[model samples]
Target: MEKWVVALLAMSAYLVFAFIVGVLAGRGRSFWSVSEYTVADRGLGLVLMWFLMGGTVFSAFAFLGGPGWAYSKGAASFYILAYTCLGLLPWYLIGPKVARIGARKNFYTMGEFLGDRYDSRAIQVLVGVISVLAFIQYLTLQIKGMAYVFNVLTEDAIPIWLGALISYGIVIVYVATSGVRGAAWSDVLQGILMLLVAWVVGYTVVYSFHDGVADMFRGIEASRPGFLTVGAEGSGMSPMSYTTILLVSVIGFIMWPHLFTKSFTTTEKKIKQTVLVYPLFAIFLVPILFIGFAAVGVVDPAQLTGPDTILPHLVTHEMGASGIVYGLIGAGALAAAMSSADAITHGGSVSFGRDIIQPLKPDLPERTQIWIMRLSVIAIGTVAYYLSIFGAAGLVQLLVGAYGSIVQFAPAVYGALWWRRGTSTGVIAGLVAGIAVNYYFQLVQPATPLDINAGILGLIVNVVLFVGMSMVTNPAGSRADEYIKA
Candidate 1:
């Protein structure tokens, strides 16, 4: 069979398999139960929680973008690997407490949790808006990554728009039908497939280009100095930028509504176990960077359209691997993108209904809320799909922008847990100020005095303002202490 045909068939089979897994996993749950839809009735075990949380973090960015960074920026790509291990460790300290409160309060959304703690509906709506924007930004990149793979692997036999629709459409269906259960089960399959495929591709690419791993690194370093390590003294990213970016990501990583809300899906013990096992996923990502480095000397940079294009380019032009290998690589890339997208789509919808719409209908029936969340899934998916196809921003830029905005939520979240005095006024003001500062740095003057991301700089202001505002305002006599002590 022809190469494109083989790859296309493999990708198609992968999607069909994923769909079956998703639908089946959601089976036997109560159709009218909002808890079932949003959190699998808070009954996830250790194994499922492991995949659910693990797969959520290993996004399309990890698949395509990880390699892209390694290929383009050299050692700067190591920043991704560095942060992943640290990012989820804090979950051990916080996840159980959050989950316990969520179980006690019947809270399904982070916005609800925050809004209740601060005694402000306004904060809920504000978080709802932020969550929606950040979610669409995050989902757009995953859709774009899947589209890029389909476009390249099939040699444009599948156009970008159509490819995105086909892939993301499956995600929307499973999420709408199965909800979190569907997504969690799907992650079990996707996380396993992508991990295996990454190592295979990473190892194969290195050997295909040179004698072995040592020779591959040596060849790239000899050709391009300072490309294999982080920070200056090397010709890579500045040390401050590298260190601070990782810090921003690690701190803000759990603050993402999608990841944060996972607290409601499983037990406290399961969440802790998931946190313990997650670093292995970080370790699993190392070989992905190797695939990028493997392409350095072998593939001409001038032929590539973008850094993200390196993986597909290598598979088609340079790997000299069999047709099946090409097919598996394509499937693996889709698995990465769709696995993360389903969870984000599910989480975004729940946030929309709970944060944005639930306030409009506080007395709405549980069945009604469930339907609204399902509808929000489709609506959010459509908006994100449109942006993915037409948006001018690159994947990395969109991700960075989303991260900058969402990281501002960390102060409010952590404050809810530990700081008893944080009021709604303080969090709202801090969130607003953080976003403005972050936007100015991101768009108005991207080149700051230092190589620091605007997000990190914005975070410093965000924390300071939050603390200052809370102290001056009358603190809520709310159950801030109760939630903390629980």
Candidate 2:
């Protein structure tokens, strides 16, 4: 068999194993209950929570986009590391509170908590809409990443559309059957495999090129002067842009529905302990960056067709006919894609079932809601599969832009937690204004009026509207007050 075929088979085998493990993980449970399906009865321990959270965050973007950015834009790529570290930092404090409240209230979705806190179904619907949209976009990136890996490794023998369908189809099946429990268990396996692959790739690049880390930097300096530093000539991004991107990601990371919903799955103490170990998860990314740096000076950026393809190109070129390395890389890439996709597919289903469907039909049976959620997994997975096939060139940028709207939730969420005066009117108005501003800025101009991210600009306007409108409106009544204190 061809090396590509062997690699593809290895990846397929790993995915099959993951599905088996996922199915087995939830074996004795009654998935008919929303609590069992959505949040695993809110009883996860630290180890599973750590891997699930870390694996979801360190996605295909981390493995694929991190290196791609570093290879193409130089120091600006450090934004990946910066944003990741800073993103999880806030969770140490915020997560425990969310977990405590969510567990107490039996909140399976973030929308449920937000709505209950504000005593407004409108807030629930709004959060649900945003969560679904952002989850779809996030799923699109993972699907695209999987397609790119398959296409590159197979040299287009397997078409991108078919590749996406095959991989994402498996995700839908597993997630539909097992929900968050499956996603978490599969993530543990994927996380370990991908980490090992990252180290191997890093070492291979260094060894093959006959260069240590110091020598690699020296080569980059000689060929691409100031490449180690930000704002060098030929670097595609400005320092200001880099800093703002990092800021946006740091602030926006936990706002993701998949990550936030995980708060509902574990205990408060477990959540805090998970945060303690998450920084160590960030350290696993260093080797992935080293792979990108190794490509510099060795592979000309201009010669590469697209930044996402850089890693695959380097692997195939460097490893030659070594079937084992190729298989390992393919498995790692598939793991990254599968781990992320499963969480998103599961999260989206929960949002649709718990927040959207139940609210529309309050009398619906819990078993029916569970079935609807299972079907939603397939529905959402299919939509994302098609979108990934037809979407833009840079999967990471599209993901950032798509999910950027979630940051608008910061005001509503924080206010619900701390501010007693925040009203439903203010939250609705602010979300609309923020989304409108963010959309206009993204489509009309690449940068905001002041060179900040469009989302940041929108967030400023969102906050102003939220605060301004809250002061103008009547304070949330005794129920809202009680909910906040609860």
Candidate 3:
């Protein structure tokens, strides 16, 4: 009868539904083979691939941090729109090639793809280390977003840590048991649920105060000018920073280990099709900006401690904590968080097993490797859970930090695919240099020439060093030729 009780019930029900879906989806697959466990035996069709990719991207950030950005940062949030439109275009060109090679080489991890290209375990190890760190960082943000949703909705009936433990625990179990198949099927539910909830809730929040979406924005402009456009001097980020962020995101997004390895889970054509249909997913996310913008003038900024909490605050206060409304919000937010967590957690585990553990043992049985991957979920999940509660960084900060590191992978990945002269030494040097430059810009300087994104600046340095070293160094032509033919 009470609001918290209804919300608790709704969230609990959603968890049960997710667990059932995860387990059932993985039911008939052979669990003994590493490929079966990690890539669903490379049999995912177009629809499942579509939802899996979409659900992975429409993360807890999209639900919480997205609106938070809109609420706090204004026009800077439009960068998400810009990046989403342009990001996957490069994937259409690269994904099919990667998928074809992955099928031939029996590669299920991004590290495997690159390490083989350069004939270097060091490359795999580098990718493994970077990917694991980035995965934990990413999972931490989503878990925080998830926990925040639970804590705010139940009025702390479910505290942040406990809420994370309960929901993320489902993610661990499903991923450990079902592997990528579990993650993909659960994403089907999550992808559809979240898109619907985002639109409904976005419209609801806007219509609450103003007659329509346009009126809502107009009122915000009248009340808080410069909140709708970038470089407006209030909450707007620099235009140079905005455009650079979009450019780096478009280049680096598909380079994420989870998204890159996804190429292995389906056919080459399916990979292309996934990219072709992704713009619709981009369109689906626009209204979430409205939800964030809706709360700007109406809610006092001083009242809430952080912008990340703004959306939840709106649901609890503006929706009058209505049982059904709050319940749907919980279900949707849970979908957003859990969906992304499962893929990331699974990808981290696979990277650890395929890249880290399997190479160390070399002769480890396939079954043993699968077990290591399954157990790696708990290991990585524990780290992410602990960090989610204790980490000092905010949601957007963590996501941005992780993105900065991930884009550095592009040089190695693209070199393996297209550049015949891309030597192992050169790729390794470039990756290290890129990350170093990125971190230096990120923490030490915090300002770049012309206000370009730190990541892009890092990429420029990375590319120069990579190309220069490759020109002087002997090309790994035969290996690259083999890859190209695949």
Q: Write the per-residue lDDT of candidate 3 for residues 181-274, one digit (tens) a residue.
A: 9999999998888989999888998888778988888888888788788876685798888888888888888988999998899987888889
Per-candidate TM-scores read 0.98, 0.96, 0.98
Ranked by lDDT, the better of candidates 2 and 3 is 3
lDDT of 1 by residue, 271-367 (tens): 8888888679889999999988888877778998888888888988877667798789989999999989998999899989999998877899988
User: lDDT of each structure?
Assistant: 0.88, 0.82, 0.88
lDDT preference between candidates 1 and 2, better one: 1
Q: State the weakest 10-residue window (summed lDDT) of model 2.
A: 477-486
Determine the C-alpha RMSD for candidate 1 after optimal superposition of all C-alphas.
1.1
Q: Candidate 2, residues 233-327: lDDT per residue as tens digits?
A: 86667777677777778778888877888888887778778877767777778878888888877787777777877789898875474777778
**N/CA/C clash count, model 1:** 0
Which residues of candidate 3, in runs, are more than 4 Å off?
none
Give, for candidate 3, the lowest lDDT window spanning 10 residues.
Answer: 475-484
Q: What is the lDDT of residue 302 in candidate 3?
A: 86
Residue-level error in angstroms, candidate 2, position 280? 1.1
The reply for model 1, stretches above 4 Å from the true place, is: none
RMSD for all candidates, in order, please.
Answer: 1.1, 1.6, 1.2
The TM-score, computed over Cα atoms with residue i paired to residue i, of candidate 1 is: 0.98
